[model samples]
Target: MSVRKILVPLAGRAEDVEVLTTALSVSRAFEAQLVVLFTRPDPTEALPYLGDGVSGQVIEDLMQAAREGADQASGRVKSALTKIAGDAGVPLAEKGGEVKLPSVRFLDVTGRRDEVVAAHSRLSDLIVFGEGTTGVAGGTALEAAMMSAGRPVLIAPQKSWNPVGGSVCIGWDDSAEAAHAVTAAIPFLEEAKKVTILCVGGKELDPGPGSTLADYLELHGVVADVHLVDAAGRAAGEVLLEQAEAAKTDLLVMGGYSHSRLREFIIGGVTQHIRSHATIPVLMAH
Candidate 1:
């Protein structure tokens, strides 16, 4: 399937530019429309938390402040969007309009941020997320998108980049999640100049070998090289990232949250490690 529309959620954080740049690169590659969404937390959410001693005026003032903060952030996000899209030569347009060029649109909404992001993601072909500020909000949005959207999510790198999807790497483990990821990444795989399937640790190949995946990709007219890596007591995620870097991969495709999120958080799994520390773009599916 082709990526026709890309959704990028911006929180007016420091990483907004990096995220927008990454999304625009992919949009250019696929000639897709980019939807830059700005979701603001509902100011009334703080009302229930006000203590008994809090006066009505104080509560009203707090809500006003929250609203002002959200408005300021929205302005900053829109300014950045205008500058980036112009620099990339992508025109801005409205939703449901006929267009002949690679275009972008801005969507501003107020609600629970994660819920709003998840709802919008359901209508898009792909979702792009930045490594947001360290906290629960970013992780919540990611989980919501993966679980609720049923769409591929592309995690932008730590830095801005162009010409993504040129060289690709797939992290295979023979699990259903990994297989789903491979299917979701068909658009990128079919277009990449180089594709590598890296199976880290012999254990993951027992159920379905890397060759099997290679053969599957061949059916889609994608020629891939399979490499079996020996983890040798090192973290599998570390090994996978190192190999991908060595291969000069621009995009890495893999399953996310293959195990339960709780288990991964407690014991540390490949998905967690990569999510926490990848230098390149990652395309993931659940």
Candidate 2:
């Protein structure tokens, strides 16, 4: 499938520049449309009933703070988007149809950040995230996107970078998620200067995923290097990061391994770990 639409959530964090830049880069490479959001954190979600004797001023103070924060976030995101778009030569086109540069637009959403992101993500083909607000706030948004969007999520590192998929590493496994990730990443894989399929442990090596994926990639005219590592009781996410670092890969493509919570939401294990600790960018799918 093609990456024709990308969604990026701006949480008013410091690292949003990296995430937004990455999204624009991908959009440029794929001629995709970009949808950005600065989700307003809902103060009412935690507004407790402070009893009948509660002071109205106290409630007003809390509400004011939340709105002020949201307003600041919106301003910062708009300013950054404008600068990035200018640098990339994207016109401020209101109705898309920017053939030379990616079309960009922002949504003014009000709700719990995570819920707002998940609901809006349903319209995107891919969701991109930067280092998430340095807390569960980012984690919750990532989880919501993965669980609800039924698409891929590209999580960027906390640090800045320029990874145009010139070199890539694939964290290989034999699950459905893994297969989906590979298919979802075909565009980048095809353009990569170097591509490696990495497998850890016996089960992953049993089907010779490294070779299998290499062969499959070969059909698309993408030459890939297959490498295997001993799991040694380490988490798959950790092992993949190690191999990616060793190979000096620009990007890591992997499956988002997750379990359903409340039978409707998702809480990922490897996906969450990699998203949190990765120094390079990760492209994930479920």
Candidate 3:
């Protein structure tokens, strides 16, 4: 199960270059089409603040500035993505296959990030976005797409990254959401040479579930290792992260269990923690 199309939401911020690079790499590996989308605030929505008394000159000037800023950001994002694709030796269609780059397309959209990402996700096989700090709104687009588009999301950190290598660590909880996430992530796990089913808490809570998942993966020709962590004093998210780091896993696949409205995520402490501070990219489904 390889991805055939990927939607990457770019903010044109410097921090997003790594995400763009990661997306391109994945696109090349899977021979998928890459769609880079830049989102801008809708100007019409701001018109309510400009009263009828406002001078035409002022309005024109503001609009021009907005347009210029949007153009500049869009250009930067395009250039960065193009360069990454070129370095990877993937062919760019517009270049007539002379320049190696992925089949890339750029879309500049105005309005809300969530809406734009959700629309693209509906047309794509996967959504990729950058992960930021805890309080800050990092990976908001990815989260929104997951909830609204009913697709899987890949959240990459803001540093240099490599396509997932080695083993994939799966956080197993035996819930319906977890099952869905596992199924959605089968593409990645099948590609990975190794996989681990990690369970937190005691057998009294749930014991054999993780083993069953591991066995299922083994049947698919994926080498799987199952382990249980006590998660006593430490947070579940922290424990998971620590285990992943120790195992040197390249990717973490987990279910996103949420209790609150889609507007904001009200998730378990572990989920929130991993969403806020995981070093490696996370592939999540709800």
Candidate 4:
């Protein structure tokens, strides 16, 4: 699918710069609209969680503090967005309209950050996130975006690069999840100058996995080079990372594997490892 609208959630933290830069790179590639979502925590939402024993004065104080925190965060986030847009030569606006490539808008909303981001992301073509965003609150947003929004999520590394999706790499495992990821990444593949399909431990499959994927991409006018690598008892993530880095890939497209336990979703080990260690942007879908 074409990526026309990209969503990036910011909490006014230092990492927002890297995330914004990475998102902008992608926006430039697709000439897409970058929506910077800043969700302020609703002070009133915490009142019920505080319970009835809290005195009126204490509740007021807590609410005031929450409001102050949100205000400070909003200021920082806006300032950072302005500076980044200026440096990248991208236009910043409060409203969307006819604009140049890599245009951005700051969206301010009050509510639960994760829920708000997920709700807004439903309409977006892609969601971009920082690698460090896999933490508690960020992890909640990531999970919601994948499970609820059902959109492709791009995890940007701490460091930012230009011309994202210029050189694309795909991790093919002949799994349903991997197929979904490929479908979601068609736009990038179609636009990429170099495309590589890295298949790990695929020698055992009856039909060559890499050849099958190559044929599929050919149908889309995307010529892909297939590389078969032996895991050699190494973790799949480790091997994939090594190959991608060797190729100097700008984007890595792969499946996000997860399972439920005790009513909670846990990211698969390989996916988690790549998120934590990859130095380039990773596009994933569960």
Candidate 5:
């Protein structure tokens, strides 16, 4: 399905601006409305923790500081969205004979990050999150946004990415999440001239599931090739990367399989490996 509306969770960080730009590009290509959301922590939630030792004046000062921080973050997010929209030729207003360009709406939300994102997801066709700019925290935010939103999330790594083109790689395992990822990625797959479904496992494991997905794609008139890797000695992530490199793939579409509630911990084997080391951009769905 085509994405008609995209939600981008902005953190107002420099790195996140790049991710927002990429999201805008995708939105423009799809002729979609881009909703930029930023979350501000609620002030009332902080007052309960203030001890008796901290006077009323002190608490008020702290609250004011927090509000100021939120306002600053909101301004930065709005500025970035405006800049990107202009870059995409989305005009702010009409001139004498010129048509005004499409504009993005910046939403300043207050509450928990996950909760805010979840609410926005109900109204958006897709959600885009940036891989954390600061080590583990950033990665954790990206993962949480995807899980909480219950929608497709495109995670842009810290490394450089060219304009996404060429063959698309689908990391298949036949799970429900894999199915969702495949369905969510149809827009990209339709544009890709070539598509590859790669399953890294042995004969003892399931193979028919991926084949069925390939057949489904064939029904949709998409030309896809399926490959099964034995996973002889290398890790699954390593094998997947090797194959992607060999094929010169620019984007990877796969189910983000994980069981950890706190994604910052990196508890699961496959999830940990892919989050920390995947070389290509991953379109992940839980």
Candidate 6:
């Protein structure tokens, strides 16, 4: 399906601009609505961290501060969203509510950060995330979105990225997760200037897996070149990266999955390898 709405979880913290801008880039690629969900920390959680002598008034004060900070930070977020959406100096007041500017919308959601994102993402076509910019929710919200939202997520690297769809590479596998991922990534593949399906494993490329997917992409008017790569004892993730670099791919489409996903992240697996190593953006749908 076409990506019509993208969910970007925003914690009124640092790197908000970077994350929002990355969402904007993806939104522009598909002319999708950028649903910016601002997740503010619950002030009551601060009580434990407070000094022993602190009272309810201090709690109230912290709540007030959080509200004020959220307002100010959200304003800046809207301003930056408008600017990056293409029309700058549009006056912050005009940029407040929903405008025709960039299909940009905002919602102030309170609760656990990941829960909020996963809840709202049910209506979104895709979820976009920054590298590791975290707040009170910590950094695992992306994983929550992936596992709970039942949708695809585009994870942007730490550095700035633009024109994310051009020159794409797919890490092809026969897993259900891999299949779902490629389908979720169809919009990006359709928009890419060049599409390369990199088949990892020691097997030869055939009509069953990689070539079959290539054929399916062709049906959608996406011409892809399928290349089989022998891992040669190397990790599948490493093999995918080698091909990605060789092809100069800006984005890699792969399954956002792992058996015991957490264990895969720490021990050794394709997910872990790419999560730790890939230089380009990875669009994963689990």
Report the Cα RMSD per candidate: 1.8, 3.2, 3.0, 2.5, 3.7, 3.6
Worst 10 residues of 5 by lDDT: 92-101
Comparing candidate 1 with candidate 4, which one achieves the higher TM-score? 1
User: What is the C-alpha lDDT profile of model 2 across 21-115, one tens digit per residue?
Assistant: 88888888888878888888677765675555767898889789989988998998988888888898876657545443467787778887778
- Cα miss at 279, model 5 (Å)? 3.4
Candidate 5 stretches with Cα past 4 Å from truth are 91-103, 133-145, 159-162, 203-207, 258-267
The runs of at least 3 residues in candidate 3 whose Cα sits more than 4 Å from the true structure, single-residue gaps closed, are: 51-53, 94-102, 132-139, 203-205, 261-268
What's the lDDT for residue 274 in model 5? 65
Regions of candidate 1 where Cα sits further than 4 Å from its true position: 135-137, 203-208
Clashes counted in candidate 1 amount to 0
Q: Write the per-residue lDDT of candidate 1 for residues 76-181, one digit (tens) a residue.
A: 8899999999987889986577784588999999998889989999988889988877632247788788877777788886888787879999999888888888
TM per candidate comes to 0.95, 0.88, 0.89, 0.90, 0.86, 0.84
TM-score winner between 3 and 5, please give it. 3
Best by TM-score: 1
Per-residue lDDT tens digits for candidate 6, residues 34-79, read: 8877786677776788889988787788889987887787777666
Reference-based lDDT, residue 192, model 4 = 94
For model 3, how does the per-residue alpha-carbon lDDT over 145-201 read when each residue is reduced to its tens digit?
887788888877756666764479998888776777788777778788778888977
Model 4 lDDT tens row, 30-136: 88889989899888877788888999999999989888988898888888888888987888754445665568888889988778988998999899887554552
The reply for model 4, stretches above 4 Å from the true place, is 94-101, 133-138, 202-207, 258-268
Say which candidate scores most in lDDT. 1
TM-score of structure candidate 6 = 0.84
TM-score of 1: 0.95
Clashes of 6: 0
Cα lDDT listed for each candidate? 0.87, 0.78, 0.76, 0.82, 0.74, 0.76
Task: Please give the lDDT score at residue 112 for candidate 3.
Answer: 84
